[model samples]
Target: MSTTIEVEQATGPDLTHRLRDAIQNAEFAPHQRLIEADLSERFGASRASVRTALLNLAGEGLVERLPNRGARVRAITVGEAIEIVEVRLGLESLVARKAAENLTTKDAAVLRELRGRIESAANEGSLVEYSRVNQELDERIREIGAHATATQLLERLRAQSARHQFRLAFVPGRAATSAPEHVAIIDAILARDADAAEEATRRHLAGIIAMLRAMD
Candidate 1:
């Protein structure tokens, strides 16, 4: 579920962030019209603020502005999603390597706990839970890696491709297939094996690409 921003308290940037998250989380359907008046009322912001927020989202490629027709969520094609994941593959592999190199004892403990939760969610056939934990694992890896530039790039890429990912998570047996791959990533980091971590990251993302191709 997406976090709800309290009305009357959200600034322009806060509204933009909240709306971005809503779009990414599928709360707002792809291509759904975003009327300024509707959004202003919904977010309890002024029409001017809503317009500005929409403009910001448009720049991020998450919203499309129509001439005289206002705005709507952008719907990414499967091909586009695959391309985004391809870009992520390189950056994420680098992050995995750096994470393995920088893994401290405390990081290992946190990763282990996240790994356990991922496995449990997969085993229970809980797609929602699995997706949540999988994202947490990625965030933890990024934090451990400490790559600011890559992290910033990934944040946008992930948001852009989030809807496709949400669909993929519902594919039968996907969670089961991805669970071990995620575990391999965590295990390599725990062992401080940078090479293995990078390889594992590559393999995992490669699988996602394959699935995306099959989806196409």
Candidate 2:
């Protein structure tokens, strides 16, 4: 049996999340019109609420407004995907290094718990769970760093390039490979080895590029 989400009960975050999935998961094909009336009916929201969510997605670059076509899911290009990954490598390496210097015992424990969940999700091959858990793991690393500027930038990048990130995650070997890379990052942080943490993070993202190239 398949599970279904009841979008009628959704608030802002819930609406935004569903729209994000719709765009990133390709539920609404690229260049497909997201007419307010249609989406309001489909997602069971008022036009105002749906407009708020679509505007939010527009700010993220996930949706674009046409001169007369209203809005549509934007097509992500390969060049944009590579550029986003390049930026991620630099910022995430800094996150790992700063986390190594700043993580508390409590934070390390939480990281371990997240890693456990991530590994289990990956082993089960649940793409939805793996994506959510991996996002939390990265967010936790950013939290440990306490680098407000970096986190803010990452948040912006996340909105702009979520489609690319989703595509990258679906590549073969990515989930299985990322689980151990998370372990290595956590191990480096736990040991307070900033250099190793930074290197591990860079190499991990580098592996993503390798995987992307392999897919080509």
Candidate 3:
């Protein structure tokens, strides 16, 4: 007998977002096939809705739709990973600079809290929690930057970079090193130093890029 995947009824966007998160967190490994019927049942959405979601994810490069094989999580190549980080270096530096200039007291508080959550998850070796908090921190920075266009662009870049980011985080000791980098970023933002914030963001992302390159 085939086992049934438990799925709760969810709206289109919600289901898409959930699947994206699952893919980013390594719940669905790289190149894992995403069958429409299975996902429709798993997300409790109609098959049509599932197809739409898959197409959306495909546009983001999080999933690849094969002509005959259907959709599968995208596997990032070394060259593609390097390109993603290079793009992030420029975009994230801009975000950090703007975040430093625009961060409110409330934003600072929330950022510090997120930094703590990231560090705690890292120390506890919870990759899922670490990835989740890390993405939240990125989004919060974009939010504080308040540039709608940049935020939208960064969101797309992030979706494409998810697989590479997962590989980096899953490496032993990578999370430990990244926790301090995030703290440096938060500290610069709190100090309201735009240059420092931008520089820190560049350094942090550059380090990750170097590590990835070394692995390749």
Candidate 4:
């Protein structure tokens, strides 16, 4: 039985976004076929819209198109995931620096609150909660940075590497180790120190690369 999403309207772009979210969230397992008819019924979108959405996600490296077969979720290997993170290390560092440079009083307050929640989740050893809040903090930083191009690239890279990240989150002591790194990022941003923010971002992503290599 296919699941149905409770969306009022599913335009092509909306369907693509929903599909991307589903893939990233593991609702659709890696390499699971995305049947157009199933997706159309589930999202309340037309078959044509589903095709367009699939094509769009394929372009984002989230979906694969197989000749003589339908589309399926793209399975990113550990090596590819490391490469993606290496790319992210540079882009995210830039974003972090920009975020620090553009930090406002309101942004500082928001980041501090998120930092507290991240620490709490880490202390409680809630992997799911920690991952959720960590993503939120990243998104907030991207917004504050106001770099649309980097943000778009990072979004695609993140989605492609989500599965590997999800696995890493379950590694023993991973969350606790990453918690301080996240705090450092928030601290640098709060201090409006662009250099520190960039360095902290690089450190965080470099840690991810190291973890991925260990898994490999």
Candidate 2 per-residue lDDT over residues 1-216, each given as its tens digit: 122233433565678778886776667777888899998888887677788888888887788888877898877676676677789889999989999999898998998898789889889998788988887888899999988988877875765566666777777777887888878998899899999999999999888766655555
Give the lDDT ranking, best first: 4, 1, 3, 2
| Cα RMSD, each candidate | 4.5, 6.3, 5.2, 4.3
Off by over 4 Å in 2: 1-18, 25-27, 41-49
- Which model is ahead, 1 or 2, in terms of lDDT? 1
Q: Clashing residue pairs in candidate 1, if any?
A: none
Minimum summed lDDT over a 10-residue window in model 2 is located at 1-10
Q: Which residue runs does candidate 3 get wrong by more than 4 Å?
A: 1-10, 121-128
Better of 1 and 4 by TM-score: 4
In angstroms, the error of model 4 at 124 is 0.7
Ranking by TM-score: 4, 1, 3, 2
User: Using lDDT as the measure, which candidate wins?
Assistant: 4
Model 4 error, position 198 (Å): 0.3
Candidate 1 residues 1-216, lDDT tens each? 123433423588888888888898899998899998988888888786798899888988999999988899999999999999999999999999999999999999999999999999999998999999998999999999999999988988988999998899999999989999999999999999999999999999999999999999
The digit string of per-residue lDDT tens for model 4 on 101-139 reads 999999999998999999999999988999999989999
- Looking at model 4, the pairs that clash are none
* Model 3: per-residue Cα lDDT at residue 200: 90
In model 3, how large is the Cα lDDT of residue 152?
A: 76
Alpha-carbon TM-score of each model against the true structure:
0.90, 0.78, 0.86, 0.94
